[model samples]
Target: MLIRSSTPEALRQNNSLSVLSALRRQGALAHTDLCAQTGLASATVSAITAILERDGVIERLEQKPAGGRGRPRVLFQPKRDCGYLAAVRISSDQVQYSLVDYAGRLIDRFEEPRLGGDGATQAFGQSFLAALARLAERSRLARDQVLAISISSKGIVDPGAARLVWSPVFGGAALDFSALLGAVWPARVLLANESLLVAQAIAAQREGQGHIPAIAALSLGHSIGLGLARRDRHGEWEVSAPNFGHMQHVAGGSLCRCGSQGCVEAYAGFYAVLRTAFQVPPQTIPAKFVPIAEIDKIAAQARAGHRMAIYAFRQAGQSLGAGLARMMSLFGSMPVAVTGPGLRFFGLMQEGLLEAFAETHEGRLNGVPLILPMTGEDELVFEGHVTRALAEMDVMLATGQGGGAP
Candidate 1:
């Protein structure tokens, strides 16, 4: 509700962003379609597009008539070589790096195994910077040519300062990305929670299809992560990733890696399901990794009516549902998209998950928002990183090119 109208400069930014957003969503729009998409006048679109073209940020595509008659229709699209972006996704076992062009096309990508956390913070930072250099060099681009670097990880991220505050891998060793990238490149740095990127990508996709009130993207895997994304009145996306995994579920219950007891991750995470399936003592240190094969076995057993496996999956679902219900109670009702590797086993947990939701007062009032199982978390996550980074880059280029300000 604190959201306010854009001021003079902000209005200009909105105008530029609307044009860029239209091109990004609909792809290579003619001036007429561009006006309709951005809800701007033809003159405004022409002015902005002209500035964009003059600054080499966009190019005009000519469509020849079928019979070579009359005039050719012209279209505007982002110039692929105008800028570049890098996306780094840090996971528990490995780090993935992808280079994308201004047109949101992938140029290059690779992965590096994450070394053991035997005092691995600074060392990992070194390797990551080197990887960035490799990413640029292999793509034949100078460091400065990469306009932005977007880093996503499964932990706490300070988007304002571009820092990794808390992560399952590094624990208390926080990494400030701006400081790390400051020396080698002049590009801006952005750090965001992995699930947050997923939400952004999904939000953009939904907006392209039509209006979406709000949605929550829940990641279930080695850990539980939650992200909420909504389009505000201004048609700008608002996204946030809460540390839903570590949030307390049952006080003084199972031990969590973050030194917390009774966190939601302690019950619903993959490790939690494994622990429950094996009836491991709640106080034991959680496993760093649980192979999906083991979970598959457990799921198979649960499907065969194995008592312990059934109970384990049911427990995970109920705990997850309770935490989500609490979230819905705080926020308004919204559809939930369950993503990540955990979707493979959702069939085992849907019953208990729904039952627990139905028990909540919020669920009773709202009638349990739609719970959809979404596959390909990786695709959405990468798409999100590019979408966010490129959007910011668009603002930078458009303003620098004299397109934002009147």
Candidate 2:
């Protein structure tokens, strides 16, 4: 429900954004193609492209060979050397850093062990700063060459400020990344939930396919994550990562890592499955980390008809289905994309999931066919980061906020 102004400058920026968006989606394009795709006049396209090329944000390609008669056509694409982006993906065990070009090519990447203790936040900040410095040094690029820094984590994040509002690792201690990096780094900082980026990648991939009003993505692991991407009436993309895993599913039922009772994550998270199959007391605080190998063993046991393991997976599915059904009740049913390391056991959980889903009021009333598509969580998360970061950079370019380096 947000309204945007359409002033002269705003319209020009919108046109430029449209051109950049089209190029990003379709790769290199001729001026005529840009005009057609963006609905901008030929003159406007020429003007925008000229400015972008002059600013070093985009580059003109050599003229293509003509088929028969007329003059050769010239193409344009984003200039790879014009800007760079640094991506930091923070997880419970490790933090991954990647350097990417304006064209979304990965230049360099590395992972570092995550530090944890009484002063975990302070330790992490120092480590993060060092990591960025190392990345820039390795890439042989000055700090100012990095136009943007995108950070993703498994927690509630402030959409505007690149801040971790609350994280399972930090609990009540929030980290404001915008202020942290703004003090020394001139690059723009963007923060997002890991799974939200997964949803963003999926939505961007499936753009203009059909009348898909909305899509929901679920991530399953030591913690649960959910991302929703909706196409509004004006066809603008609206995305969110509601602390869905923390949503109360059953009152006073089981303990959750967030120190709550019967959150969806209590039953659906990997640790929850371990607790259930091992007959651990529900009141016992769940383990902070659950290795993938442990879950794989459980999946193996369930495949071999182990009653406890099968029961544990079914319970997790029931919790997930119920949570998703509740979401459908509020947002209406749409296709659901399931990702994360936990999907390896989807076969064991499918029956319970569908059965529980069918029992919900939204599922029964809407009768919308459910499609649970599997995807690579890591790849999607990184792609989503690049997509979002580049989009923001495009807006900056359009608004004249970005200028060529001396």
Candidate 3:
């Protein structure tokens, strides 16, 4: 085992973590590259790599041709089978779980229907655990081999306390999943809001790219969520004010499921956009149509250039842009990444949103750029959870904990 009680083991763990992190961030790094990236001696890098390779945590790929003179250098990549982590994303309508490798690739995914309303607490908890157990069993990963488990939800999570402080979807009461899951699986667990994890993932991808200070992310789904990043004096990425969705946007737009009116989510959320697009009578709208099928149909029709569909999406974009303008003014404008289902309508709302944003801004703040829409899978939140869990593991290893056996 890589873990030991002696000082030698601590040093080994630290060195291994540095090498692993280098490979993860730079992808197939050479020995020299690892040394330079990690500020470790060449000999230390070799020793760590040797131990990691012996443990099946990393492997050397084919050597690349020499650039000019010297011998060709061998590159290393993370071994996918070494271990895996589980990423769970819980929302109002469903719970999604994935088995992700050390390289952050999701190898398998599982989702279960969510129990809605106040009665969903116990039901969702049981179903979530069962789904996780099934996924782990099917994937052949043991409980101890799960380096860590990170959960992302549509609410504010107090990680230190291991409780969800408040979730519009779960009501205001704090939901303690740590205590709940601890009884089932013994593993190092971290919990955070889906939006915050999404932001962390974005920041991790953009790290050292000179775009850290100006990067921001917006999650558009059943509810709108935002994540902002800024660089500290020490030149480290820091997340700020992750839960910024509850701010009221429309004074009299519509009543939210949380019993509030005029919030941005009330107008631009997945359900809100669907309700607006379908023109369904409020009383007649079915439960299933709110978050899934209706929004999907609208996306498909908008893609087909249906007039009403396009108009409906444009309206959603306008509402989103309006709320975003307020956020930009308060947070100082930055390069915004609009993600999630909302990006499906980026084409329909791109011009309108930009126009609305432009109409509101007086002048650029700190030369921060305008919102940059990113279109990708809804599984991004799960991906974020994986990234965060792996990063935390990397930190633990770097600090001499090896991979905790919990």
Clashing pairs in 3: 250-262
Clashes (backbone N, CA, C under 3 Å), per candidate, total 0, 0, 1
Give each model a TM-score. 0.94, 0.95, 0.78
| Number of the candidate with higher TM-score, 1 or 3 | 1
- For candidate 1, give the lDDT of residue 273: 91
Per-residue CA lDDT of model 3 for 157-228, tens digit only, reads: 785756887776567766787887888776667887777766777777787666556567788777778877
RMSD of each: 2.9, 2.0, 5.1
Q: Sort by lDDT, best first: what order? A: 1, 2, 3
lDDT of 2 by residue, 1-406 (tens): 2115688888777877888888988879998899899888999999999888888888988675766557767899999988889999998888999999988999999999988662279889988999999999998998878888999998899887778988877776888898889987888999999989988888988886877888888998889999999987898678899999999889998899998999999998999999999999988999888888999999999999999999999999888888889988888888889888888877777777778888888778876346676768899999999999988878777777755542
Q: Candidate 1, after superposition: displacement of residue 253 in Å? A: 0.8
* RMSD in angstroms between candidate 1 and the native structure over all alpha carbons: 2.9
Which digits, one per residue and each the tens of the lDDT, describe model 1 over residues 93-135? 8999999988999999999998658338988988998899999
lDDT of each model, Cα atoms only?
0.87, 0.86, 0.70
Higher-scoring candidate on TM-score, 2 or 3: 2
